[model samples]
Target: MPSASTRPVAIKIDDATRDRVKRLAEARHRTPHWLMRQAIEEYVDREEKREAFRQDTLKAWNEYQETGLHGTADEVEAWLASWGTDDESPAPEWHK
Candidate 1:
């Protein structure tokens, strides 16, 4: 992340929450600004990952719809169950 060309954004908070944030910041020995910035960054990171997963799910669904090809739930479960052992099974093949 670049510190240059950064802008500050202001948000309104309730007095109670503001006080709580202030106390928490004091206890953590960090400024409120740093705390909020860290929180926003973490939230954005988590939301981005969630969005990517959603996109992958949609793509998978669309492909399945178009080709009418997919593995059965039982097959997927069996494949997943074989995760790390002496005789791990191969992945279930997709079929129409």
Candidate 2:
């Protein structure tokens, strides 16, 4: 029985997908419902991160257009390469 925090969800899938999910669930020693829940959780997590990244990129683009200040690819690469090293430094200066 579902607990108070849980609600039942019904999803329709093609036969092939249903079979695949069953097989995967068996292999992982989990019920189909658990597998589906895990898949949905992972997918939502990944997509949310992707959406956040897209939003950040759009904001950066708008800022660049408004200020005409940006970093060159080479400078950006150098800064990225410095990550996790003793020489790690702040972002390169923005240029027109």
Candidate 3:
């Protein structure tokens, strides 16, 4: 029996895609249902992260516009260039 968190979903795919999914599932020693579930999970995870990033960017943009506070392009570039090094600098102070 499936858990409460699991629900049956019906999706329609073309013949070629359905065959591909079946072949891939067989190659991985998994059922077609498992493969589809894994694919949906992976896709949802990626899209959720992207959506979060987009929302954060929009929030930051709105805040910047409201405060007219931002770092110069050169400062931002230098900070980015220092990434992954001991010399990595902190974010520059926001300015008008």
Candidate 4:
């Protein structure tokens, strides 16, 4: 048997929105409840991604503040050149 924790809640929607959801659900062969759940999940996932990016940026900024990149253009160029990335091949990919 299913748990009561998964029980649906009743809510009111405008006619226009309800019609749109019905059409979309019909097209996708899914219930309106499922579509709404998927939409909420996607929204939460995108928000999480944005929050993670913001946190990473703040952390990097703090690190840069501690160890300033106070080098001349020539020095920066020399360091980059020392990494053996000449005009031959493309740079490495950094996919997660």
Candidate 5:
């Protein structure tokens, strides 16, 4: 019996796409269901990360607009370049 937490969900795909999935699944020794599940899971994970990044960017933009305080592009680039180096420096100070 399937686990209580697991339930079936149906999705319709064109015949061509369904055939392609079956072929790929056969080659990879996986079920069509597994392939679709993996695709959805990875897609969700990627989209979630993208959404988070977008939100963070918007927040940073709003904060900059409100405070008018920010580090110079060159300062930020230099700090980024120093990453993983022995002399990694602290982040630049924000200034008005």
Candidate 6:
């Protein structure tokens, strides 16, 4: 969703860490820098999910206050846990 910017980055990592990253890159048929970028992208995605969930929870509480009803985090978790569909069953042993 944003324009891409490219620039060279330099860092000094411990020998062991550098070696491990090089080996991982070889195994994946990519350069160590590419693997590093991939790791950074995954980290950013996880952080975004955590922040969004927190904001959503706060919004839900505000709506609840307007309705003069309140629900605890545990209560919401329990309600979500109870929701399931019979047709969405796990695969049978034979399928495995």
Best candidate according to lDDT: 5
In order, what lDDT does every prediction score?
A: 0.92, 0.92, 0.91, 0.75, 0.94, 0.76
Model 3, residue 58: distance off in Å is 0.6
Q: Supply every candidate's count of residue pairs whose N, Cα or C atoms clash at under 3 angstroms.
A: 0, 0, 0, 0, 0, 0
| RMSD (CA, angstroms), candidate 2 | 2.9
lDDT of candidate 5 over 1-96, digit per residue (tens): 234697789999999999999999999999999999988888988999999999999999999999999999999999999999999999999999
Error of 6 at 61 (Å): 3.1
Task: Work out candidate 1's RMSD over C-alphas.
Answer: 1.5
Model 6, 1-96: lDDT tens digits are 224977777888899999999999999999999998888778898999999999999997787667756555666565666568544433322210
Q: Clash pairs of candidate 3?
A: none
Q: What is the C-alpha lDDT profile of model 3 across 1-96, one tens digit per residue?
A: 235796677999999999999999999999999999888888988999999999999999999989999999999999999999999999888799
The alpha-carbon deviation from the true structure for residue 14 of candidate 6, after best TM-score superposition, in angstroms, is 2.8
Off by over 4 Å in 4: 1-12, 70-96
TM-score per candidate, chains pooled: 0.89, 0.87, 0.83, 0.59, 0.91, 0.58
Top of the candidates by TM-score: 5
Candidate 5's C-alpha runs over 4 A off are: 1-4
TM-score of 2: 0.87
- Candidate 4 lDDT over residue span 2-78, tens digit each: 34688567878899999999999999999998888888778988999999999999997787687763455665566
Per-residue CA lDDT of candidate 1, range 1-96, in tens?
Answer: 436688989999999999998999999999999888888888998999999999999999999999999999999999889889777999999999
Q: For model 4, what is the error of residue 11's alpha carbon versus the real structure, in angstroms, after optimal superposition?
A: 5.4
Write down the TM-score for model 3: 0.83
In model 2, the worst 10-residue window by lDDT is: 1-10
The lDDT, on a scale of 0 to 1, for candidate 5 is 0.94
Residue-level lDDT for 58 in candidate 2: 99
How many Å off is the CA of 34 in candidate 5?
0.5
Q: List the candidates ranked by TM-score, beginning with the highest.
A: 5, 1, 2, 3, 4, 6
Worst 10-residue lDDT window for candidate 6 reads 87-96
Q: Candidate 2: which stretches are off by over 4 Å?
A: 1-4
* Clash pairs, model 1 backbone: none
lDDT, model 6, position 44? 90
Superior by lDDT: candidate 2 or candidate 4: 2
Looking at model 3, residue 83 earns an lDDT score of 92
How accurate locally is residue 93 in candidate 1, as Cα lDDT from 0 to 100? Answer: 91
For candidate 3, the lDDT comes to: 0.91
